[model samples]
Target chain A: MLNIENLHVSVGDKPILKGINLQVKPGEIHAIMGPNGSGKSTLSHVLSGKSGYTVTQGQVTYEGKDLTEMAPEIRAREGVFLAFQYPVEIPGVSNIYLLKAALNSIRKHQGLSEVDAMDFLTLIKEKVRLLEMDEKFLYRAVNEGFSGGEKKRNEILQMAVLEPKLCILDETDSGLDIDALKVVAEGVNSIRSPERSFVMITHYQRLLDYIKPDFVHVLAHGQIVKSGGPELALELEEKGYSWVENKQAA
Target chain B: MTTQTASRYTAEYSKIETTLPGGSLPWLRALRSDALKQFSGCGFPSLREEEWRYTNVSGIEKNLFEPRLEPSDNQIDKDWLENYRLADCWQIVLVDGYYSAEFSVLAGLPENVTIKSLKESLEAGDGQIEPYLGKAVGIDEHSFVAFNTAWFTDGAYIRIPAKTVLDKPVQLLHVVTDPNRLAATRNLVIAESMAQAQVIETYVGVDQAYLSAAVTEVFVEPNADLTMIKLQCESEKAYHFGGTYVKQARDARFNHHNFAFGSLLARSDIHSDLSHGSECHLNGLYLGVKRQHLDNHTRINHLEPYGISRELYKGVLDGRARGVFQGRVVVAEDAQKTDSEMNNRNLLLSNDAEADTKPQLEIYADDVKCAHGVTVGQLDEKSVFYLQSRCVDEETARNMLTFAFANEMVTKITQKSLHDLVLAEVLKRFPQQGIMQDWL
Candidate 1:
């Protein structure tokens, strides 16, 4: 479903993602683990088509189409979703309104009529129940005055609503408590299907316990030095990235 | 036309002063003369003046318009009047600057709510009208104000009796229909002690190349509550100058909201006074596009102890338009326990668009809480990208973001229909700034 071939990326002349090559088939769950400044977040941003990133070399293909040249919204409508590391606080904009606009935009792009208010309410109620999120959160401004756990849960709720073909979770479990993390992980687990792919990025191995990955890649110094199964995450959690660092230094 | 310019203004001032109707008292005549003298002494403010630094009124001076002597009765369509009516309120329409009794409905007013024309109020010998007429906003402080005072022919007068609560809002529609015409209109509102009322004064025009000068005075007595909404949506070639002066007595509450979305060149002055234990909230939003210029100058005077005031004004400028905001809060001596906060935020959408914001606070009271902030920048790129990542196209994202910024003030409006109307007008004026070109 997704392919990255020798993708070299830079931020203001400093290389961040150096020759990253990865492939993920449908229904596959992939995890990218790296230490601090391992270009984990940068990879997610570039995949989401964020501006200000210089793609020096290589190409990215999504579903056999050129993904690097699409605008952020076009990529989003094409079923590519990125859960931001830090959710933005948009004051005075209601969460429900934003969700409705986003859903309608994607629907319109797919040659479907926009959903009415009643239908939208009915649709969101089911998602809210599945995610165990309170309906009251929809009335308030998006991410404004939200607690850390609420923000993370809100991102999961958005993912459930969007139902993207390829979902990239960036540090989704960073600020969540045990209960919140489990709920978020369950939310992700429920959306797992054969036709959809998941790319989870994290610095810790705890989130992997809830939704096990099929493939785990170690990223160090802007390059993926090792690829293994779920046991690699446990190995890094037990030992640390110091071994990877020393190997890169050697 | 240099020195003779003074005589020209003086002649225009004297010509209107002598023609005031017979119901006007001698004191009003003296006040008018004094205001005219002050105006003549100061003449027109130049761009060199610090207060007028960003605004250039050279065009206003070059094309001096003569004030209309009598109201015109041409092509006043009934559909247009109906279109201007606010939902579930008494609609008082003013045609070509004079109150139109035929189109106004005052029969369903509450028992204690008194609505009348200014001319009728003056002729009825209502002693309550004189003291608060020009007391809040002095004409001597501004040249256009003086010009309005010296020439205003007719205006709306509203008075809510003591302890009365008006359920329905009162709508005052000022419509200018004559092309290349100039009219000076005024509105006087008095909310008695413990009374509550909401008033919406809208200035609109159909004719291009016209000028409308308006001044509204509001008095909130002790324990009274007043909410005033001022909307200016004039012609594209029109020029507008409006002033709103408010006074809050002891323990009174006053809220003023101004929305400016039209006019080629528009300036609004809002002066609010909070007495002992009084409170005031002044919020404004202006959208300027396509060479439009909008300026807002607001001042809050905190007098006596335990007074409070809060102000927030935002502007969105695009297509070489300019926006200026100058907000000042003064806490006087003995006004201890005063709390005041003011903030001005602007969004510049185009390269040539400019925004000037100055939030100033002067405190003489020792015990007070006062702070002011100003920010001028483009839309947040991260926020834009965040919205876009949610499947909203760039145009929709930008429009939603800008609307959200202005909705901070629009949500404060209690009237739903009026709020929707103003929102539609704002959307039409801004047009999503081409962010939706691909989708369209």
Candidate 2:
């Protein structure tokens, strides 16, 4: 479902993701763990088409299409979703309004009829209930004044709404408590299907206990030094990325 | 040759002054003469002037404008007027600076509510109009205010009797339909002791090239309450200059919401005098797009003890547009418990767009609460990504988020029809393909 070939990215002139290559098939969950400043977030940003990042060399393909040239919105319409580490607080837009616009945009791209207000409300209400999110959240501005757990849950709620083909959860578990972590993971797990793929980026293996990954890739200094099964996450959580760095240097 | 040009310029003003309307009341005649003198001395405020630094009023000098001599038979289209007409209220219509008796509807006015034109009020032995007509604003300081004071033909006159509560809102509609002509109108509103009222004023223009200058004076008597909402949506090529001067009596409450969305060159001046124990709230939002320029200047005076004031002005500029906000709040001596806060926020969507916000506070009282804040920047990248990541395109995401920023002020409008009208105009000026359509 997703492929990255020799992707070298930089912020300004400083290379962040250097010679990175990875691949994931449908229904597969991949976990990328790295130390701080080890290009973990940079990989996610570059994959999601964020500006201010220079792709010096390499290409990214999603579902057999070149993803490097697509704008962020086009990538989004093409079923690429990024759950931000810090959800943005949009002061004046309600969450329901944002969600409806997102759903309609994707629906239009897919040659489907846009959802009406009533149908949209019904759709979101079901998802909100499924996520155990408060219905009042739909009325308030998107993520404005929301607690940390609420923001992460809101991110997951958006993932559920958009139902993207490829989901990238970037540091989604950083600020969450144990309860929120489980709920968020549960939300992610419920959406796992054979036709969908997910890339979960985390520092600890706590979130892996809920949504286990099929592949674990250890990223250090902008390259994947090791790749293994879900147990690699627990091993790294125990030994840390320093051992991976030493192994890569060797 | 140089002396010849200087004499020619002086001769032009002399020629123009003679053509102005004359033979009014002595006091009014004297006031107009003095104002004309001041106007001649100042000419047009150049960009070199500190207050006019960002605003270029050379357009006014480019075209020679004559005060509207007579009301035109060219009536406003009923459909267009109907779109702006507020129902279930006492309505007053002023067309081309003259009260339109044919279009006005006044029914079921409470016994204490007084609504009339300035002419009728003056002729009907009402001496109250003369005392507060031009007391709040200095005509000598502002060229447009001076011009409005000099040439105003007639305007709406409203007076709420002491201790009276006006259950219904009073709607004032000012319409201009002539492109080549200029109209200056003046309004005076007074709410006596313990009286309460809501005033909604709508300024409409039909011709794109016409000019409209207006001044409104409001005096809130002791313990009275007043909420005034001004909606300025003129033609795209029209020029609009307006001034609103408010004076709150002891323990009175005065609130103003100024919404400006359309015009080629528009500037609004809002000044409030918060006297002893008075409370004032001023909120404004200016939406400018394309080549439009919208400027708002607000001044609040906290005079006497225990006066409070709060102000928030937001601007959204796109497509090489320019927005200016100059706010000043003054706390006078003996105003010990005075509390004042002012904030201005601007969103520039394009690289060519610009915004200038200057918040000024002067406090003479040692014990006071005064705070001012200003923020100018582009839309948040994280927020934009958050929306786009949801499958909303970049343009639509931007529009929605920008609209939300300005909607905070639009939703504060209490009247539904007026609110919808202003909201529609505001949305029309938003950047295309941004979040405007869905929320609007």
Candidate 3:
């Protein structure tokens, strides 16, 4: 469903992502483990078409179309989603309003009619229940004064509502407690289908314990130095990222 | 040139002076003569004055707006008038600055509550208005007050008895129907000790060039509570000047909400004086589009100890519009433990749009606490990008953000019909795509 070949990304004069290659078929989950400054966020940001980052020399294609050419909103309508690590607090726009607007935008892009108000409410309520959030959260301003765990779960709820084809979770487990992590993982696992894919970018292996990935890639010094099965995550957890970084250096 | 403009108005004053209200009362006649002299000396406020530096009233001079000697017998579209009239309230209608007994809705009003025309009250010779007419704000405060005092034909007179709680709000609806007509109105609202009331002042007019200058004096007696709302949605070609002066007695509470949405050029001044252990809250929102210029000036005075005051004014300027906000807070020497905070925030939506904000805090008491802040800039880019990624197009995202910025102030209105009316007016001034009313 997605392919990145020779991905070289830089922010201003600094080269953040050196050279990376990745391929993902439908219904696959890939966990990218990295230490500080390993360019995990850079990859997710580039994939989501965030500005301020120049793709020095690489190509990313989603569903056989050049992903970099699409505008952020166009990419979102085309079914590429990026869950931000730190969600922005929009003081005036309510959370439910945003969900309706997004869902309608996607439906319009696909030449479908706007969602019925009652049906939209039903769908949204079901998703909110799946995420174990209060109905009041849907009416309140988006993420304004929301707890960290609540924000993460809100992102997951949005993902479930929009049902994007390719989901990029950026540090979704960073601020979540054990309970929130389980809830988020369960939400993600429930949406797993043969037509969808995911790229989980995380700093630790703790999140992998709940939402196990099909493959694990160790990213260090702007490159993926190791790729293996789920057991590699357990090994990395036991010995720490230095095991991979030192091995790459030697 | 200023003297020349003043002379032009002075030349026309003699034709209408004899027809003005309260002409039979000696004291009111002397007061009107003094006000006329004050207005003749200064004319309209000029840019030379510190307070009027950002605004120029030369347009009023050039237009030569004339006052209506009596309430016009012109037919008014009831459907159009109904838009500005609030439901479930006692309404006093003033057309071209003269009270319209035919259009007013005051049936079933409480017996003790006095809601009548200023001219009617003056003709009764009750002498009830003598103490509060110019007590809160004298003509010397500015030339607009002087001008309104000299030119006003009629206005609403509202007074709630002591310890009385009004069951329904009173709305003063001012409408201008003729081009080049001047609507000058003077209003007095008094809530006696331990009373509770809410009042609304609405300004709207036909699509034409005219002038509407109004001055309202409000008194909250000891331990009384008053909430006043001023919604100005005049014609796009009209000029508007409205000032609300307030005096709060010991332990009295006063709240004001100012919404400025229409007119080619408009200015509103809201000033309040707080006594011992009193509280004052002032909230305002101004939205300007096209070449419209909206200016809001506010001042809060702490006259006695343990007084509290809060003020917040937000503005949204689009197109070539220019918005101005000037706020000041003063704490007196004997007003120990005075607490005051003032904030003004402005959002400019175009390269040509401008926002000028100035916040001043003057403190004389060592134990007082006062703080003020101001901001003038564009929308937050992080917020824009966040919305964009959420599937909203760039244009809709910007519009949504702008609408949301102004909606913050609209949400504070407690009256359901009034809130919906103000919300509709606000939405009309901006792009409404993707901003559904049901969402709010």
Cα lDDT of all candidates, in order?
A: 0.85, 0.84, 0.93
Ranking by lDDT: 3, 1, 2
Cα lDDT of model 3 by residue, B219-300, tens digit: 9999999999999999999999999999999999999999999999999999999999999999999999999999999989
- For lDDT, candidate 1 versus 2, the one ahead is 1
- How much is the lDDT of residue B40 in candidate 3? 88
By TM-score, the candidates rank as: 3, 1, 2
Regions more than 4 Å wrong, model 3? A238-250, B433-435
Which lDDT tens digits does candidate 1 get at residues B1-440?
Answer: 13245457577665555555423687677776776776677766667777777777655665666666665667776686566678888877777677788867788777667887776676677777778878988876677787777668778889999999998888888888887777777788899999998999888888577778888898999999999998888887888888899989999999989998889999899998889999999999999999999999999999889998989999999998999998989999989999888999999989999999888888999989988889999888889999889987787778778877877877788798888777667667656634322221
Candidates in order, TM-scores: namely 0.96, 0.93, 0.96
**Model 1, A91-201: lDDT tens per residue?**
877888788878888999999998887988998988888878889998888899999889888988898998899999999999889999999999999999999999999
Tens digits of per-residue lDDT for model 2, A1-250: 8999999998988998989999999999999999999999998888888888999999899988999889888899999999999888999888887788788889999999988889888879988988899999988988999999999999999999889989999999999999989899989999999999999999888899999999999999999989999989888988877889998788
Instruction: Report the CAPRI category for model 3.
Output: medium
Q: Per model, how many backbone clashes are there?
A: 1, 3, 0
Task: Using TM-score as the measure, name the better of candidate 2 and candidate 3.
Answer: 3
